[model samples]
Target: MKFQQPLRNWGGSLVILCLLLYLTLGANSLEPLLGPLAPENAPAIYARNSFIDLVGWHLLLVLIAISAAAVIAILAALFVSRPVGADFLPLARSLANLGQTLPPVAVLALAVPAVGFGSWPTLIALFLYGLLPIFENTLAGLGSVPTTVKDAARGLGMSPLQRFWQVELPLALPLIITGIRLSVIISIGTATIGSTVAAKGLGEVIIAGILTDNLAFVLHGGLIVALMAMLLDGLFVKLERRFATV
Candidate 1:
């Protein structure tokens, strides 16, 4: 597990660092790329007062959405990657194709009727949209497990479970992480759409901006979402590198 140590260390450290950065920005509105934080409407309300709520709640929505997607992804990976005859692969591919082809907004629209607005529908739409990346990568990683390794495990009288756990899964971890990275980034961006349903997310800022023609609010919201996505992606990359076999 020595090879995994660096990944664990860096993954934890990077998240901590990003958290610190987020806290700093929350406290001070540090990033100038988003322009001024705008003056609050009251005497006691500081210029950046809303920034704290915006950043905090936006992050909360992202985590909630990502968690929903993760559950979908993990279940899909478990079910889809199993040794179903080669026949099942094409079905997975076709389904993934369809999933990706449907616009997320359309999915949200369709879901809104059934699920009836709010974060639940938004969460479901994002999870469905994310399914392709996770499913495809799981299939690819499982398929690409080396024949020699499989043979060696079998030759040693290892059970299928043992071989998969000890060899195939470990090797496939990087690809799985890649899929998760894609999913997380997409989730973060898509989360903003939740605001359409009156679900709080960074999208509120964008929606507010549009309603009032406030460019600064839009930029502020959009920039934070982008930063959060980039930060998470960097952490994933570090995890991938750390776990990558030397």
Candidate 2:
């Protein structure tokens, strides 16, 4: 029963992982299936870089970017939600808003001259693009805590920090997780554009397909990206529900 439950819980993850493995490891083997999808004179496979390597690098860049954005956003939200830090709320919101206001491609274009090409520019763009949703959701989660609950925590002689950790944060975690989910999905989609700057990612395949008119390459890259987003989103949804029940 335990094994069965676990299998059921991870069914989607397993399926996607299997598909990703088949697509990446057996891409060349797919010539029969994908041959018809390739435009005349264009290759059926994206062979410039191994699809697996591109997927790995893409995930790595996103992980780094989203981790940074989440930390900064959550901390900023925490500070601004505090009474002593209330005055800085507008500034914090404005900072987060500014990041989301600009398109990721623009950020990448502007960042390239400053940092040059490759993963760093992509990281910068993803970090900036991912900031707003997490920041806003954190703020909303903290704000949603009931005044009565705060009073109750204080009535128990808990310190502000203790109350936040034990009470407020627990209540707010679900929404914060939701924000992270949104940020993750956005970062995944935006990360595709990073390949334009010589950053390693699934975008390499998509961009190559566009340039060469290879529909197979485009579909292959887009499929992986979409699957990754769905998997992460499902995991986050589970976390959100788990925390909400607590």
Candidate 3:
């Protein structure tokens, strides 16, 4: 009976993956299915760039942005959680929220002037957007470790560094990963906007739809992002459950 669920999930995963492949690689095949939705006399497919390249660039941008954000956020959270750095927590928090406080468009506007168009502005915007959740989650995770656990580590003659590595970090990993999961998902959605400025991602397909009033193109791109997001969310959820069990 337990094995039945895994088999079902495996089947579902294959279906979603096949649909994703059709949308990204064989979009032309969808023309008949989507024909009525497209504007009259317009091509239903997004032909500016390969959808494969768009997906690749989209992933690259998100990965780089979130990776940079995670490093900074996790480090700041670690520092401020310690006794010596506790007083600086507010500062760290404010910095983490600085991205969320300003809309991505505003960041892009400000960044474009300094960094110019293309991926740089998009990367900066995503980096800023990813900071708050990671920092807050890591901080919360560290704080959730019981006082007795630390004492117990001390009781075992472990140093502060050893206590953190051997005891606290493992307990806190699930939440830290939760922060990463959130960041990764948010970055994926946000990276789409980078296309407006020629950053070249799935957003290009959506923008094309909007410009030509082709709902099919928009659906094409949206479905691809949505499916990929679902798949990734499922993967992270499994990770969260696995670690929670541990």
* Candidate 3 residue pairs in clash (backbone atoms < 3 Å): none
**Deviating ranges (above 4 Å) for candidate 3:** 1-14, 94-101
Please provide TM-scores, in order, for all candidate models, with all chains considered together. 0.77, 0.90, 0.89
Runs of candidate 1 with Cα error greater than 4 angstroms are: 1-56, 85-87
- State model 3's lDDT: 0.83
lDDT of 2 by residue, 1-246 (tens): 124333224687778778878888888898888889998887888888887788888889889999999999898899898888989998888777776777767877888898998888889888877888999999999999999999999999999889989999899999999999988988888789888998889988999888888899989888888877777776777788788888
Report residue 150 deviation for candidate 3 (angstroms): 1.1
Q: Candidate 2 — which residues are off by over 4 angstroms?
A: 1-10, 94-99
Please give the distance, in angstroms, between residue 232's alpha carbon in candidate 3 and its true position after superposition. Answer: 1.4
lDDT against the true structure, per candidate, is 0.69, 0.85, 0.83
Error of 3 at 98 (Å): 6.6
